[model samples]
Target: MLDALRIEIVEVSNEKVVARCPFMMQPDNTLDSFMGSFNSETVASVGSWNLLDMENEYAIGLEISANHIRGESEGTVKATGFPIHKTTMVWEIQITDENDKPICFSRCTTAVNKRIKKNNS
Candidate 1:
């Protein structure tokens, strides 16, 4: 889905992760605006990627809520995820837009999962 939306990961660190996407309108429309689902996905992607980078463990999104404040019809939109709180196996993430605006602020709860080894039988 990231490939289809052209979402790109621009940065990652212990504190935050950033993702970018260019504004693209629907085929039959000229709005050039993105859907709320896209904004939600961007938040989850950055949040999940941050956990993976920090812990070296796969993180599964357990819950997410996105509040879209505004929409853009031009320019690129960037989503940055910050770890506001965390437990041993879960993280609470907050996301903001490129202009430091609240495009779609979200809270994501992710659970760290262990990768299972496959048996080559």
Candidate 2:
């Protein structure tokens, strides 16, 4: 379960994409207890590049293929982090073509809502 909540980078052929944010820890408090206690559900992800214990310093660089003949790209994600179930993040990648031209560029926001229990709680 922890594996799904972490940030990662995937390389396909000559392109690499990095996804990350700033967050750490699984439920310090149980949901059963949490649901039964608070007036409102407290859910949030603070910081860009929501990486685990490590600080959020995320980046991705890719090399264009020799012939540039690919269409779509994707990869299965296997990562580890805290708040186990949900991890919120935003990812952006710019694909440059020959002559340093931007062939494709994309930005996506994945809001995985992983619950966390702060010490103040």
Candidate 3:
């Protein structure tokens, strides 16, 4: 899905993660403004990316809520995720745009599950 949307990871750290998605119009020339699903995915991706840098656990999105303030028809948009709060098993991420604009504010809760290894025996 990320590939289809051309989402690119800009940066990642224990504190935050950043990503970019280019604006592309549909065949009808109508702007495919970043939708709720895309916003949700961005949040999840950032959170998961951060988790991957931290441990060998699988980060799965349990829940996400987004509030899109406005839509853009051109230029690339960037999403930055901040670790607002977190528990051992769950994390809360806040997303903002490149200009610090509230494009789609979201809170994502991710479940950090330990990776299980299969025994070849």
Per-model CA lDDT versus the true structure: 0.58, 0.26, 0.61
Model 2: per-residue lDDT, tens digit, 1-121? 1235433333222112323222232244211221111101111122222343433233222211122122222222111112322233443333332233432333333344334545785
lDDT of 1 by residue, 31-111 (tens): 233444455545655666655644346766677666655654466666666776644223333334456555556566666
List the candidate 3 regions with Cα displacement exceeding 4 Å: 24-36, 52-56, 88-98, 117-121
Q: State residue 55's C-alpha deviation in candidate 2, in Å.
A: 15
TM agreement with the true structure for every prediction? 0.64, 0.25, 0.68
Model 3: how far residue 116 lies from native, Å: 3.8
**Candidate whose lDDT is highest:** 3
What shift in Å separates residue 79 of candidate 1 from its native position after superposition? Answer: 0.2
- The better-scoring model by TM-score among 2 and 3 is 3
Question: Going through the candidates in order, what is the number of backbone clashes in each?
Answer: 0, 10, 0
lDDT of 3: 0.61
Q: For residues 6-94, could you state the per-residue lDDT of candidate 3 as single tens digits?
A: 88877777777777777565554333444444645565656665666354566766776666566555666666667765553233433
The TM-score between candidate 1 and the true structure equals 0.64
Q: 1 or 3: which has the higher lDDT?
A: 3
Clashing pairs in 2: 3-79, 21-49, 21-50, 21-51, 22-49, 22-50, 22-51, 25-82, 25-83, 26-83
- Please report, as a residue range, the 10-residue window in candidate 1 with the lowest summed lDDT: 88-97
Ranking by TM-score: 3, 1, 2
